[model samples]
Target: MATGIPRTKWQSAPHHIQPNGLNSGNTDVHLSYEGKKPELEILNTPPANLRQLWPSNAGHVTPNRLYYGDNLPILAALAQDGSVRGHVRVVYIDPPYATRSVFQSRNQTDAYMDLLEGAHYLEFLRERLILLRALLADDGSIYVHLDDNMVFLVKAVMDEVFGRANFRNWITRKKCNPKNYTRKTFGNVADYILFYTKTENYVWHRPVEPRTEARAAKEYQYVEPGTGRRYKKVPVHAPGVRNGETGKPWRGKNPPPGKHWQYPPRVLDEMDARGEIYWSPTGNPRRKIYFDQSQGVPVQDIWLEYRDAHNQNIEVSGYPTEKNPAMLQRIIEASSNPGDLVLDCFSGSGTTLNMASHTGRRWIGMDNSREAISATLRRFAKGLEPMGNFASKLESAEREEESEDTLSLFGPEETAKPSPAKTDRHHAITDFALIAQEPGADDLADAVGQWLEWKGESRIMQFREETVPYKTGKPQKLHRAKRRKQRR
Candidate 1:
């Protein structure tokens, strides 16, 4: 490839096209270039150890946390920390778009992924892909985002690194409206996203549930024969134990077919007497589940949620690097089950963690940029307003025990300081380099790393470690559990 763009200018007169010959050296046309700046400092102080970069929980945890650091160093730390090994279900990265924009950090060499003498930008992402693949669970998937410029190149490397056989889909998503450029023939209308699965057995959420018309017409078509009352049926079984002292069959002629009864004989008799049991003319029994109980269509993967944060984003951060929430939500929803740990090492503006928590998934977010970190924290604060209503119900249960300790303890302090609002990643890295060189942050860094791992929900699983698990063939009630909320 040509090392760089050559200088050029159009001659004013069409007939004077060859006039450029004489004025060539002293012509208005001029080439552009730059002298080098100091970028890399050979680490006089030993480079941060790769093994210790990760906090304890990095290799494990679903619906995990976000981490802020040089992603490459963090990846090395993960190689040892093992927090993500065989744990990640999906990887969705909106990698740098290869616009050849500036990338600066304390160590200048860290920024030069592709700006070298004979570098191909694709060469940069290749090394990261190797580790990212290692961290993926056997049955996992990955999605990589790019623009038209490098889509094909990135795709080929992804195929090579992750195995072409595991290829999933290439999505052409509408990124924005239009752009105008002098030499450009076509205005960019969209960019592309490449999806790949780790293995064929990977789990994928089907956005829609199937409806059997036969069942729908028979049960959900609740137009009564005579009274014409539109009442849908629901199981009449009152979940727990029943029947005086001994639990007996209640909902039907049988107790869930396999398990012991939920209610006693009398209650079962009462239910039968009330016609709660919808029996065929043959006297067979079954329960009715209504139509109104169903929520709307399950959310699909094609995201239309967050727009480029122009006006709305200013309402958010007005930051250039802020990611689309709709995109973040889709990634979180599709890859993680509720309560799973989610991590965003890049953690720009905390969009990933914010959206994850909004959907009830736990998250970890970190950013070298204090601005990004503060932006995320504020966004999360706004989110807490909605969470307050949902959590208010639970607050009543815990209040009596911790009555003296107020909710204010959970709130942010007046001293909370937000980072600079819109520093780019380069400047952010520069600031972090300076901070890393300074002395006081060791304790704070460790604390920040640890706090990112805390998800209050993990305590329950820890508590249950000693208890014997329930045995098979014993009936268990799973009524309260429904389809976990799918968000995007």
Candidate 2:
């Protein structure tokens, strides 16, 4: 028998080593279970039949998209579509956490069920992730939001799907206030977001926050005597030894032992000449960083300021498990640029889509819950109330003392303080197409019909009615009831 290729030649094969020069050993380190299918099989899964809820008109701009269906099949269809195959820039998903509970809305209406557990849940997410990966652009990023219950397990699955090398940050966010729990464990007020990239090259805009007065005072303590500017001095040398000019002595001094100057001698001389360098009496040199020149402090992994709405003054869609809009704003700004497509498959109160629209990014949101759809539509039509400030009850009491006006929701008493105009509050995009998948599209149409009837003239009229045929080869028309007289 012919002798097999030499070991060196086999090891030198392209498949044996990754582009980054890391050895990709033959052994596959992946999670294996009874129901896990091959990646190829998952990719080949049948695509769903997407039916537009309304016909698009010429007046509409580049309309965003909203889907009402199971995300898996919808994602499968998107994966095969040439336009969306690899064009999505950002994806943020907050799927069910396998808590085995039925989540409801504020009115006790059933929203969704999270009954899958163990291997079944794993497979469920794995399949969707595989399709999402295919739909992601080469320079794209995805954030998977989850609670403590399934974060660790899902992290492993994410590592397997997105590759361990592509993993970015496990961002921990304080989702709520302190909880007084009877359980033996610590209070669970934090949730995690697993960030990942499609490839080594990805879009990233650094996020920063204005430093607090206390923090600014603590960090920029030194004040320049001449310019009265707040500045901080840092070491002029960096770690590591160099044999070039950076290691050479400048003037009468050299870099500290085993270290090198951060800049070349000529550059250091320029900085010193320009008054950007500080010199000590002992002949040590340091770089001066001015507080006025700084943009702000870099945002870190730990987040504490983005707690959920806990007060009645904060306006919300009344959708259970709704997230803070500011949190989604930060993520959208950091990971994507204007006009880039942002997707959220588990679009619960449509917070992601709303923020994306507000931030000038195109978005696509999908959810299977009928209640979620109704809530999202209503939020888009009726603007959210402005958040009221209650930093101190004394301040509020003082304001009340100054004015005899009383705030009331009914009668002439409402004249004291009217709600802010719709232009001042957050509202949904006027142009977006709604789509529902087949087999259940008819039912979704009926539900939407009822919602439109309930809303009457208040319903958004941007979308024109259309008769779309589903898989059953039957055309379903969205009906609107006659306007009901306003109640006294």
Candidate 3:
């Protein structure tokens, strides 16, 4: 797994390359795996089948899609399809941490299990990463959430799957407030998210943090007259000596020693003419920066804000390991634009999906756990208001259909076409599709596939009426009982 460039060689170079940071310099260093060929061959094999069960009646309201099943095969199916392959703009996955613990909902419903250990777990995640990489557009980016348990391993896998050159940031996120561990270790309160892009030219809308009161007071101490707006005066010169027009005389004044003008001489003259330049009492010239005109401060990698929801009032989904919506919103906003597709394969409580829908971004979500699916459905249902008492009307319509079915079974005469029940329920925003059993290539059309249409600014997907239960096998009992027994 060693790279072409030796550590000593890189150390002898100018910059100090951090181990956790991006390897930004020199293309000579490349991550190589001895078993890369076999892994690639295994990943290239397509899913056995891509069978679609039914369209979620709820899914049609928005361009979002929810798939129920393992993400590996679902991603493979997406790769096989023409419309979705190389079309996704953003991907955010918060996979199980291999903690070897069983997770349950607040009501003791079995959520998911994280039992795989060591290499097996690594390979399990690597296979999906391979397909995810193929599914991304050239400008797409991915953020993989992980704990300290396996962040380094996954980082290596990501570097190999996605070229090392595409590595972006190792963002450290403060997951919770604090932890008081009984064992001999420090409190674990943080997790890491590895961010990478598919190619050099990637979608990036720089994120910003709101200006704090203290920061605003310190940076913008000056007040402008007539308007009384907060302002700051910054030197018009920058580091590095230059011989260009920026280093030349401005109004017969030369640049300071070992510094060059931030702008050209003509530009400085124009700023002075427009009253943008502040002439100090000591004859020093600086540029005026207004507080309201600033776009806030640029966001950094080490995030202290946007912690996870700890209490009932703070958390919306109550799904175990559910992420904060604001965090997801930031990732979506920074990495994608309106109408672009966002993907969350391990969508637990649909936090990413909810954020994507609210922000006008199309999304696709997949999960194998039945509890996860139910949570997501309930979340979306509450968030979406049906037109009128449409729920009651739909129930009534369904009851009538049942009655008609009974009548048709008893009569031998030809059955008439049932009239379409129409309400103001016009445009749909989301579509739900299920991949039951693995089908062959011939079943592509019959399988669940989503088709989208735009109504003004909102895009809707056509949903078919169908439901296929997820096959998650037997549910595990909660560990609460065991802990209670031990207390006795």
Model 1 TM-score (2 dp): 0.46
Better of 1 and 2 by TM-score: 2
The reply for model 2, stretches above 4 Å from the true place, is 1-28, 55-63, 311-313, 385-424, 445-447, 450-465, 469-488
In angstroms, how far off is 317's CA in candidate 1?
Answer: 2.5
TM-score between candidate 2 and the true structure = 0.80
lDDT of 2 by residue, 117-192 (tens): 9899999999999999998999999999999888998999999999999999999987654544327987676899
Error of 2 at 365 (Å): 0.7
RMSD of each: 23.7, 11.1, 17.2
Per-candidate TM vs. native?
0.46, 0.80, 0.71
Give the number of the best model, judged by lDDT.
Answer: 2
lDDT, candidate 1, 1-488, per-residue tens: 33332234333555544655645663332212243111121111122221112122222223343343455545544444344556666666666667756443211212322232213455546656776776677877777877787787677777767777788788765454233332546654467779888888876764433344554555566655564543366544343333353345333354443233445567657866865556768765655444544543464434333334431222344334455665666666776677665555556656666566656665544444544443443444332112123224455466344443322221221111112222212111100111111122232343333333332223223211211211111132211112222222
Compared with the true structure, the alpha-carbon lDDT of candidate 2 equals: 0.74
Could you tell which candidate, 2 or 3, scores higher by TM-score?
2
Which window of 10 residues has the lowest lDDT sum in candidate 3? 479-488
Give the runs in model 1 whose Cα sits over 4 Å from its true position: 1-65, 103-120, 179-184, 208-306, 311-314, 364-370, 381-488
In Å, residue 398's CA in model 3 sits off its true spot by: 45
323-348: candidate 3 lDDT, tens digit per residue: 76778888999999999999999998
- Model number with the top TM-score: 2
